[model samples]
Every structure is written in C-alpha cells, then in structure tokens.
Target: MDYQIARHNMVENQVRTNKVTDPLVIAAMEEVPRELFLPEAKRGVAYVDEDIAVGGGRYAMEPMVIARLMQCAEIAETDVALIIGAGYGYGAALLSRVAETVVAVESDKDMTASAEATFQSANYDNVIVVEGDLAAGYPNQAPYNVIVFDGAVTEVPAGVLEQVSEGGRLLAVVRAEGKVGIARLYERENGVIGHRDLFDANIPYLPGFEPTESFVF
Candidate 1:
C-alpha cells in the first residue's frame, strides 16, 4: 500500500476539506508515520478513513477528527500539551513536533509499554508516556497549555480539567445522546470553564469515562 499517497489524500480530502488548515498541524500529520503506531497486521489501514483499534477497546481517532482537534487547539511551538490515550504514541509524536513538550497518558499497561518502546525506537525524546487511569489526567505536569483527549468521552473528567492552566484550551470528542461532537473547552480566569461545540464526529469511547446512572427522587 502507498502510505504516502493515502496520507496525502487524508490531508487533502479529510483534513483540508473539513477546514483544518493549520500548516503545522497539516505538516505534522503528513510527516508522522501512522503505520508505525498500529499493529503489523493493520499497518496497511493506517491511512484509511477509519479508527484503528489499539487495544483496551479504544481506538486511534480518524485522521479528520485528529486534524480538527489539532486545528482547534492551535498548538504552539512552546506549548506544553497533554495527550490522553497515547495509544502507540502517534498523537504524541505529532504534537511533539509542534509543541515544546508532549506528556502522553495511557491507561492500559500494555499500550503504555508499546508506546514507550515505539518512542525509544523512533528516538522521540520529547514525548513522555505515562501509564495511569485515563480519567485522572497527569497533574504532576499540570497547567498544560493544551489538552487533547485522544478518544470520545461522555464527559470531561474534572481531574483532567484541573490539569489545564488558566486560559488553556482543551479539545475532545464528547458523546451525548448517542451523538458525538468535537467540543472545545477553555479555562477562564474566574475559575470556570467554557465550552463550544466545534463539529460532529465519530470517535472511539475512552474507558473510565462512561456516564453514571442517577436515581430520580
């Protein structure tokens, strides 16, 4: 399979056509070898317009979703970004090229191990892969300039929000009422958060973010 051609099509048809015009984001997506993130059997489908499963019932978001989220974040070269669900560290690698540092969090131990190996193999020194619960964002490296939830979630975990610095930005595909939309949230000065729905999208649901039941009085 011509991975380069597929990546080009993904950038042109999936990303640019969908209004993801950030040059840095486009270049990062084009340069990142997505095939390296997927299992050997699924490498051929790395550039396809679909989610590639990365175990633990989670999946890498499709190219359009990733591009849209990156565009929304407006990643800066000096920004410190946190990527939830690192998978095989593809997103982290992409962000590392644009951001000053990328702290990628993965809940699954196996996935974290794989990501660490991939990072070492690729000689990526800026990406830090940590294994922990997805709902609990990495606070030790708190006050991130940008926070990216790599998969869909029913709600933005409060712990994750606490990790964002004031005026920081967060991008995630939020699932509600069986519909998924890319939601952008910003931290405000008054210790509050504001959110805006960017666009509808389909992304794999992240573990530990399922909605809990409530009893009516």
Candidate 2:
C-alpha cells in the first residue's frame, strides 16, 4: 500500500495544515507505522484522516487531532509521559519517541499484553504497557512530566491531575457544551494546574472514564 507515502501525506497534509507544526511530532508521526497498531484487516486505511477503531470501545485518535494535541503538550526530549487508555499502543509509541519514557495505562489485560507485543515488535523500548484503570492514572509512576488521555472525556479527574509533576503538561480532548469536545492543554506550576482550550475536536470517549451521572432535580 506504499505506507511510507501514505505516512508522508498524513503528516504534510492532515497534520501540518491543522496547526500541528512541532517538528518532533511531525517526524515521529512520519516514521511510526500507524498500520502496525491496527488489526491486519484495517491496515489499509491506517493513513486515512479518521479515527481507527481498535476494540473495546477504544480508537486510535484521528491523526490530525493526535498531532495537534502533541504539539500543544510541548513534549520535551527528557519528559516522562503517561498515556491513559493505551488501546493498541499507537499513541504510546509516538509519545515514547518524543518523550524519554512512556508508561501506558490500560484496563484490559489482553489489550495490555497485545500492546506490549506490538511495542516489542516496533522496538519501542521506552514504553511500558500496564493493565490498570484508565481514570485512576498510573500513580506508581506518578509525577510524570507529561500525561495524555487517548480519547475524549467529560472532565479530567482530580486524582489524574494530581499525578502530573510540577511544571508538567497534560493534554486531552475534553467534552464541552453542545455535544462537542475541545482539545485542551494543562500545565502544572507551583502545585497548581492551568488549562487552555486549544481547539475543537470530536473523538471517541475512553471506556470507563465517563463522568458519573448526576440526578437533575
């Protein structure tokens, strides 16, 4: 399928045109084989400008959305990252390339095992895929310099926000009013986290991370 060409097009067209100008992200996205994270049957559409479903209600986020989030996160070469809802580990792979280390938290054991296998196959040695609750974040590796949610969420849990290191960054597609989500970036400084709405994004919600319903009177 000339995947190299497809990857190039994805970066030059889908990503760059969408305000994702970080060279590290552009280079990482260009090199990482997106199809490797998808089921064999779905590899053909890996470069398409759409979210690729993996399984268990999780999806590999659309290329442009991911790229823009990464750019907004402002990843540093020495930063340690935590990826929530790792899914097929595509985002972890990309994060590993930009950051020094990436710890991916996933709820399903089978998915974690599969993600580990894919990481090994792809030689993503800086990534660790572990089975854990997506909403809980990976506190064992707490104080991460960067934390990224792989899908949209109604709100970022406080517990999850507490794990970011002082001066760290967190990026997510936060569900907003009008049934839409906004790509938001948060920075922690002086023990306080500040967020900025980056752009609008429509992505799948992470399984089990949805906010609990509140009864309306």
Candidate 3:
C-alpha cells in the first residue's frame, strides 16, 4: 500500500477538513510512520480512518482524532507533555517533535515493551516510556505543560489531573450522556479546572475509567 499517499490524504482530507490546522500537528501526522506503531498484521491498514486495536482493550486512536486533540492542546516546543495510553509511542513520538520533552504512560506490558523498542529505533531521545496504570498519570514528572489522553474516558481520573501544572492544558475525548465529546480542560490559577466541549468524536474508551454501577432502592 502507498502509505505515504494515504497519510497525505488523511492530513489533507480528514484532518484539515475537520479544522485541525495546527502546523505542528499536521507535520507530525505526515512525518510519523503510523504503520510502525501497529502490529505486523494490521500495518497494512495503519493509515486507514479507524482505530488500530493494540490489545488489552486499548487502541491507537484514529489519526484525525489525535490530530484534533493535539491541535487543541496547543503544544509548544518548550512544553513538557504527558501522553496517557501511549500505545506503541506513536503519539509520544509526534508530540516529542513539537514539545521539549514527552513522558508516555502505558498500562499494558506488551504495549510498553513495543513502545520502548519503537522509541529506541526512532532515536527518540526526548520520550520516556513508563509502564503503569494509565489512569494514574506519571506524577514524578509532575506539572506538565500539556496532558493528552490518547483514548476516550467516561471520567478524567483525578490522579491524572493532579499531574498537570497550574494553567496546563488537557485534551481528551470525554464520554457523557451516551455521547462522546472532545473536551478541552485547563488548570486555573485558583487550582480549579475549566472545561469546554470542542466537538463530538468517537474514540476507544480507556481502561480503568468505566462508570460504576450505583445501587438504587
């Protein structure tokens, strides 16, 4: 398959059309080889407009969704970024090119191992892949400039929010009322969080963030 052509089409047709006009995000989507992040069996469809399943109930989000989220995050060259569910490190690699540093958290051992290998192979010096629960953001590298959840979640884990610095931006697809919306959240000066819905989007649900059952009389 002509992966390059497909990637280019994804950027021009899907991302740009959807209002993801950030230059850094467009470049990252064009430069990063999405195929490298998927398993060999799924590499052929890497550039397709669909999420690539990465096992353990996780998936690498579709390119346009990721692009839109990154654009909303407003990544800066000097920004320290944290990527949750860093499947195969594709999102981390993309952010690494735009941010000063990237800390990627992955819960699945196999995905973490694969991401580490991909990082090494890509010579990504600014990316650190750590294996842990995705719901618990990497706190040791606290106060990140930007936080990106690679997949949708029913709720933003408090643990993840605590890792963001005051005024830091967080972009994630949040599920509510049987609908999913791209929610952009920012830490306020008063230590409160403010959120605004950007657009409706469908993304794979992140593990460990499912809504709990409430018993009723």
Candidate 4:
C-alpha cells in the first residue's frame, strides 16, 4: 500500500475536514507513520475512519478524534506531555513532534513493548514508553505541561489533574449521558482545575477507565 498517500488522505479527509484546523497538529499528524504503530495485519486498516483494536481490549482512536484532541491540547514546542493509555504509541509520536517530550504510560506489557519498539524504530527519542497502570498516570515524570488521555474515560481522575503544572492543558474524551461522549479540555489555574467541553466524540473507552455500575445483582 502507498502509505504516504494514505497518510495524506487521512490528514485531509478524516482530520482536516473534521475541524482539526491547527497547523501544528495537522503537520504532526501528516508526518507520523501511523501504520507502523499497528500490528502488521492491522496496519492494512490503519487509516480507516474508525478506531481499531490494538490488543488487550485497547484501541487506537479514530484519526479525527486524535486530531481534535491534539488541537484542544494546544501543545507547545517546549511542553512535556503525558499520554494515558498509549495504545500503540501513535498519539505519542504525533505529540512528540509538537511537544518537546512525551511520557506514554500503558498497562499492557505487550502493548508497551510494541510501542517502545515502534518509537525507537521511528527515532522518536523524545517519547518514552513506560509500563504502568493507566489510571494511576505517570507521576514520576510529574508536572507535565500537557496531559492527554488517548482513549475515552468516565472521568479525569484527581491524580492525573494534580500532575499538570500550573497553566498546563489537558484533553480527554469523557463518557457522558446516554448518547455521544464529550471531549473536554482542562486547564490548571491558580491551583485549580477547570475544563471546557470542546466537542462531542464517541471514541472507544480505554478498558479500565469505564464508569462503575451503580448496582449489581
């Protein structure tokens, strides 16, 4: 397959057409070889419009959703980012270009290993893949200038928010209401965390981030 062409089309059609107008985000998305982050067999569908499973019940979110999150984060060149649930590291790769450093945490050992190999092969020296509990976040690299949840979650845990430095930004897809989910952008201000709903997205939820049941028989 002509991956370069497919990457370009994904950027133009799936991403740009969907209101992801940030030039920095667009350029980073266009440059990352997304197919490399997928399992060899799954690479065939890397640029598809929907999310694809990356093993252990985790998924790499749809390109448009990823692009929107990137735009919302407003990653600065000097920023250090933390990516929760870094599926196959595609999101980290994209963010690495926009942000100075990235710490991607993944709970699945296999996925973490693959992501590390992929990042190394791609020469993404600034992006580090760390094995850890996704919900716990990677606090050892605390005080991130930007934090992004790579998959949908029920809520942004306080632990994660506490890691964001003052004036830093965070973006996540929160499972909301009965229908579509809400894409939220959070900012740290005066030692407080505030968020704005940027858009609605229905990306697949990261396994452990789902909301708990109210009752069980």
Report, for every candidate in turn, its global Cα lDDT versus the true structure.
Answer: 0.84, 0.89, 0.85, 0.91
At residue 166, what lDDT does model 3 achieve? Answer: 80
Which candidate do you rate higher for lDDT, 2 or 4? 4
Structural similarity to truth (TM-score) of each candidate: 0.93, 0.95, 0.94, 0.97
Q: Say which candidate scores most in lDDT.
A: 4
What number of clashing residue pairs does each candidate have, in the order they appear?
0, 0, 0, 0
Candidate 3, after superposition: displacement of residue 204 in Å?
Answer: 1.6
Query: Which candidate model has the greater lDDT, 1 or 3?
Result: 3
Model 1 error, position 98 (Å): 0.8
Ranking by lDDT: 4, 2, 3, 1
- Which stretches in model 1 have alpha-carbon errors above 4 Å? 213-217
Q: Model 4's lDDT to the true fold?
A: 0.91
Query: What tens digits encode model 4's per-residue C-alpha lDDT throughout 63-125?
Result: 999898988888899999999999889999999999999999999898899999988877999
What is candidate 2's lDDT per residue for 97-198, written digit by digit as tens? 899999999897877888899999778899989998888999998999999999999899999999999999999999843478888998988998999898
Better of 3 and 4 by lDDT: 4
RMSD of each: 1.9, 1.4, 1.6, 1.2
The 10 consecutive residues of candidate 2 with the worst lDDT sum are 205-214
The CA lDDT at 82 in model 3 is 97
Steric clash pairs (candidate 1): none
Give a tens-digit lDDT track for model 3, residues 1-217.
Answer: 8989988988888889889888888999899888888888888888878888877787888888888888888888999999998988888988998999999999889889998998898898999999988888989899898999988888888888877788788888887646655555655466887778887787778887655667899
Task: For residues 114-204, write the lDDT of model 1, one tens digit per residue.
Answer: 8899988988899999998888889988989899988888888887888888778888888864665556555545678888888878777
Model 3, residue pairs in steric clash: none
